[model samples]
Target: MVVTRFAPSPNGSLHLGHAFSAIAAHDIAQERGGRFLLRIEDIDGERSMPEKAAEFRKDLAWLGLEWEEVPAQSTRLANYEEAAQYLLHEGLLYPCTCTRKDIAARNPRMGPEGAVYPGTCKGQSLDPDKPAALRLDVDRAMAGLGELSWEDEVGGTQIADPRPFGDVVLVRKDAPASYHLAATLDDAADGVTLVTRGEDLFSSTHVHRVLQELLGLPVPTWHHHPILLDEEDEKLAKRRCSPSLADRRAAGEDGRALARQLRMGEFPAGITQSNA
Candidate 1:
């Protein structure tokens, strides 16, 4: 069965971009008679608002979408810790004590996400007691695993290359797992067969494919659909203070009508979708 998921972080209100993504996943599963799952990514303890998750449920229900709920990331800490331990035991993970400021000062070349970390603590004998983030040794991880690839519904077969990410973090000093590790494990755990998300995350799939292989997790097809953009061509984001679904609902707008219009490529004024 084509099990699809729309995993959203419960840090803020659901915006139109989030609505579009959820609708995409929901419709895909519905069309295939497959299961649709919802996973709340509320691992950021400091920023995560429990009430936002409830609002997300209300938002999805308002949009006429249904999904089976899965355990949130916060509730899956042990799973992430176990995987991180496995990688650490296999010598695939190394502890780094470098702060973001320390990394940025090095003037490192940028990658898909941001400034790639320079190997400052790769071989250093850092104090184990010091708080440190765990980074995956991507070079060593891919040493023998040659010519890896994964399929995408939109882009077809894509060659997996995670070297550019430069020792991506698997565990953070403040959190049990990084998004790369947690999301990969959660997807496998939840039996997600089709990972539907925005196209901006397309490059991150390269790193995710590597994690799935290294951790011996089930590989799933991905469909990175076009993201909804604002009039300025910027992706709608909570950080950007984008208009949220709750706001629309409070204004007496019909969510089903909005969803139907979204399906037909009709967006509100100042909203448009990126090229698929």
Candidate 2:
């Protein structure tokens, strides 16, 4: 059966963009008579508000979307550690002690995500006691895996090239695992066959494909749908303080009606669709 998931971080409230993504995933599964799963990405340490996860459930329920709740990221730390150990054993990962400021000081070339790491500590053996993040050796990981590609629902087949991201971090210094590591593992563990999310994360699939190949995990087809944008043409984001679904719910708005409107491409006054 086709399985899709709407994984949301519990760091903030779900906004229109998030609701749209969730409804898209839920509809995909429902239309196919498949399973729609909800996975709470609550691994942001203290920044993760556990209460927000309950609110997410309420919002989804309010939208008349049903989903099977899966093990959250917090409960899957051991799986992340195991995968990290496997990669470390394969010599595909390295410990880096470089800070954001240190990388910015070097004026590193920007990549899809941001300023790519310039391999400052590539071969250096820094103090082991110092806290460090585990970075994937992109070059080493993609050595034999030539011409990797993944299927996208809208964009068709995509060539996977993670070199531009440099050595991406798998395990952060503060967090147990990065989104790349955890999300890939979580999808595989939950038996998800169709990964759905906004188009902004399209580039992330490159890095995720590499991780799947290295970890010998099953590759799922992806659907990077258009994301909602505000009046300024910026994507609706929590950091931008976009209006949240909870606020609308508290106003006694009809969530199902709103979902239907969103499905029909009927956005609110100031919201518009932006292509990826």
Candidate 3:
């Protein structure tokens, strides 16, 4: 059976952008006569609160989005760990301990070099007892990816040469598995054959695609749809920037209203309602 999923981090409440992606994935999978699953991305221990995760699920249910039951990503680290170890054993990953400053110095064009990472420790060693993140050997993975393209139902065919990303961190220096790692593993584990997400994550597909090849897992069909922006025309965040989804829902904004607003080709406002 074909499978698809709407996996979200439990760091914040579901927002209008999230609602758009969720509806698209669920509706597409249903139309294709496939299964739609929900996986709580609770990998970030510090920010992932049980209450917040509950609010995400509650909000989705209220919006009438259904899913096949699984506990959550926090409960499923065993799967990710096993996959990471498989890659490690296959020599697909290396240990990295580069600091933010070290990475920024290497690639100025790299966005927010603080996060782009120079892969300083790709071949170096640290105290075995000291903490470190696992970095993927991207050049090797690129050689593995070769030239492959997938057509999206909504976004169109996306192509890229996966040679420049360099070795990226699979595990964060301070966190276990980063979003790309966990997400790739989650899709593989759940037998997902289709993936529909926000266009903001379009570049993220390269990272996931590499991981999928390195793990000997099948890469699913990808559809990166447009995001629903707020009045500020900015991506939604739970931080000082965007309002929380729970707050919006409590104010009585519904998904139907959001869909209509976006379909009408409305641009988000320059200034949004103040959360503070």
lDDT of each: 0.92, 0.94, 0.71
In model 1, pairs of residues that clash are none
Question: Where's the lowest-lDDT run of ten residues in candidate 1?
Answer: 120-129
Tell me how far candidate 1 lies from the true structure as C-alpha RMSD in angstroms: 1.0
| Tens-digit lDDT track of model 2 for 1-276 | 999999999999999999999999999999999999999999998999999999999999989899999989999999999999998888888889999999999999999889999998776543568899999989988898988889999999999999999999999999999999999999999999999999999999999998999889999999999999999999999999999999999999999999999999999999999962
TM-score of decoy 1 = 0.98
How many clashes show up per model?
0, 0, 1
lDDT per residue (tens digit) for residues 68-140 in model 1: 9999998899999899889888888888999999999999999998999998888654367899999998999
Off by over 4 Å in 2: 125-128
Q: What is the lDDT of residue 73 in candidate 2?
A: 92
- Measured against the true structure, the TM-scores of the candidates, in listed sequence, are 0.98, 0.98, 0.84
Superposed model 1: Cα runs more than 4 Å off: none
